[model samples]
Target chain A: SQQGEEDPQALSIQEGENATMNCSYKTSINNLQWYRQNSGRGLVHLILIRSNEREKHSGRLRVTLDTSKKSSSLLITASRAADTASYFCATEGETSGSRLTFGEGTQLTVNP
Target chain B: EPEVTQTPSHQVTQMGQEVILRCVPISNHLYFYWYRQILGQKVEFLVSFYNNEISEKSEIFDDQFSVERPDGSNFTLKIRSTKLEDSAMYFCASNRLARGYEQYFGPGTRLTVT
Candidate 1:
């Protein structure tokens, strides 16, 4: 299926704390991307990490990819109430063309 | 700064009826795609279009589904017959290249089939 599976289906944290979410996929991928969706709104792209890259960072977001384990993790440092949203991990398979197989996503709630 | 845009933010249709969802991608982007997310489910890809033709499509994009780029600016997805299960949030996305880059997504159209 090449579907990405995310763990910790939901997480709640206080502002100024850190929250982490993990995802595991079944097949080889070209790249993995993280996206955030606020309630029923559109998805906002967060970060992209290639298979060859082990880690990357953007602002308060940090992403790590381990091809050997076919797993990835996203960490949001110093979380804010505004950061409350559903975080999804999507993977572009090596042979899947432009299609992105997404995980079920982790619902995050950051309390102020 | 260009982003994807979709029309009819919300649509309600009866089962067996046809519906067409519209989208206008980023001006310079060449690759366009349609994806959907059922309530509380994962986002699933339906089709990918490039150069005005379908380059790739998932099994979910069955005979009931069709895509077209009738004009230079608009891309459309038509469902021959809506099923109750077809109700979902449909998102349109686009990218400048075919791969390796993030695809910009639209606000999405919520289709409610009754």
Candidate 2:
């Protein structure tokens, strides 16, 4: 299993606070993607950072990747109640084409 | 603002019965994929299709499971004999191309096998 593992399985924060989740993998990857799932709905693509890239940002979401450590982190700033959901980090292995192995995910709860 | 779409949002069937989950990927997308989540478990990749052929498949995709693009606009996943363990949320996703960065996912079909 080339899947990554996310740390801090669960998190809780107040509306205006920040939430940070970390993921660590064992193999070399071509790219890593972050997705958000709201309750029972499908996953929404949040961000993607390539192996060569160190940091990327999209609106309130910031992602950082460290190839040396084979780890990545997702930071959500000023979270809202609506941001409560599961966040997963998926890795595209160097040999896999369009195939993604997803982590267990981090359950986030933001209270307003 | 195109998105992937799936039919039969929820289906309940008895064990050993066959079920087909349908999905219409974003038009113009060249790569399609199927994934499933077993309730609280993490999402797992089942297979990926491209250029009218299967590009890759995981160990989970076995003889009991198959995928087809029976028409120009529809992609289907067929479970020949669904077991109680098959109960899960199946998601369909597609990207503009294999090199495309982001993948758009469908709302998913919830399968409940009794």
Candidate 3:
């Protein structure tokens, strides 16, 4: 696994179902952020959680960080067809000077 | 909402040719960065610029690559001589804070080298 690696590289689910993606990293980070990317498009910022923060939420997205476990999870509840996109978790190292190391990303498909 | 904008959505250039991918980050953002995705691969960082200078860069950003904020609004990445493997989607991103903040990315410039 790389610095940031997301599990379940691909996921498919019903429109009203929930989607959960997990990410793990090896190094200590100052903050972790999730991004959504439609195929061949730009990245959309989802949420950011600092190392000291355990959880954060925005709209239908919930992000949890467990630094002790070096892992994070993004849960999209009551997902809709428009929620279909690739989700990536990126880490900013404590001393990396704004460099964001991104995970391979989980390809999510919400079938309506 | 303010968003990052990039130019020439698609650029096709021959190997060894010079190509500059342009970007206009959010007006209020202070930090700028360049990243690239080689097709199905993960997005990789290229460089981060702040205060009109490069703050950090990745190993992949070699001598052939250079970044410049020629003016107040535009940030550009110039690949002096393109390589076959240089074919990838280049994304420009910006953020208001140096850390603990989300970065906004542009639609990306797909550079196809032949």
Of the true interface contacts, what fraction does each candidate have? 0.79, 0.79, 0.91
- lDDT of candidate 3 over B23-51, digit per residue (tens): 99999999999999999999999999999
Stronger candidate by lDDT (2 vs 3): 3
All DockQ scores: 0.86, 0.78, 0.88
Identify the leading candidate in terms of DockQ: 3
The runs of at least 3 residues in candidate 2 whose Cα sits more than 4 Å from the true structure, single-residue gaps closed, are none
* Highest-scoring model, lDDT: 3
Candidate 2 CA-lDDT value: 0.93
Candidates in order: C-alpha RMSD to true structure? 0.9, 1.0, 0.9
Task: State how far residue A68 of model 2 sits from its true place (Å).
Answer: 0.5
User: What would the per-residue lDDT of candidate 3 be over residues A70-93, giving only the tens digit for each residue?
Assistant: 999999999999999999999999
User: lDDT per residue, candidate 1, A1-112, as tens digits?
Assistant: 7478998999999999999999999999999999999999999999989999999999999999999999999999999999999999999999989789999999999999
* B13-85: candidate 1 lDDT, tens digit per residue: 9999999999999999999999999998889999999987899998899999999999999999999999999
